[model samples]
Target: MTILHLALADDWTAAVDAGEYRVSTLGRTLAQEGFIHACADLEQLRGVAGRYYGEVTEPLVVLAIDEELVGCPVVREIPEGAQEAFPHIYGPLPVSAVVQVTPFRR
Candidate 1:
């Protein structure tokens, strides 16, 4: 299955160079947040983007991760104040697990 993570263009570039991604969300890291947030579908991705990245003007990209290729655990859990569950990767995402990278537009 494919899961999507919204990422800053620069971060993604860094991940490409480093071989792994550790950002958990905007302005946060995997070490700080403990997991990398991901969307299960495009609709969910839209909601997350609107809520967290609405005012940001920086270039963004969507990393389409192939779950089976990810070495870490992918858990589905509801975050605080949310009615639905989101996929959370419990370790740094390896760049090799990302099947596609698409530019994001608001």
Candidate 2:
């Protein structure tokens, strides 16, 4: 199964720049499957994450991933001072907060 990740952007422009997620050979091998990345705005991601996590909540990014890949999406949030990664989460994120969305395959 393929696992996809959705990381939220700081703003609308960031969303556009985020574009689609891609997986290289190394990434594919690491994931042990395919991967895709997507971007969504805070409000939109909030709605999706709200429904996912139950009740209304805000998330930095809403990740759409497959069941098999749920536990191992391969890619995760980059730590501070490790060189900013694309589709990075900006602003403050709560410790209790995570914005992974259910797989919405098209």
lDDT of 1 by residue, 1-106 (tens): 9999999999999999999999999999999999999999999999999999998899999999999999989999999999999999999999999999999977
Model 2 vs. true fold: TM: 0.21
Choose the strongest candidate by TM-score: 1
lDDT of 1 at 90: 98
Highest lDDT scorer: 1
The local distance difference test score of model 1 is 0.96
lDDT for every model? 0.96, 0.33
Candidate 1, clashing residue pairs?
A: none
**TM-score per candidate, in order?**
0.98, 0.21
Q: Write the per-residue lDDT of candidate 2 for residues 1-106, one digit (tens) a residue.
A: 3223334333322334544232322123213433333223344434434444353233333444333323333344433553423232222222223335443321
Which regions of candidate 2 are displaced past 4 Å? 1-33, 55-106
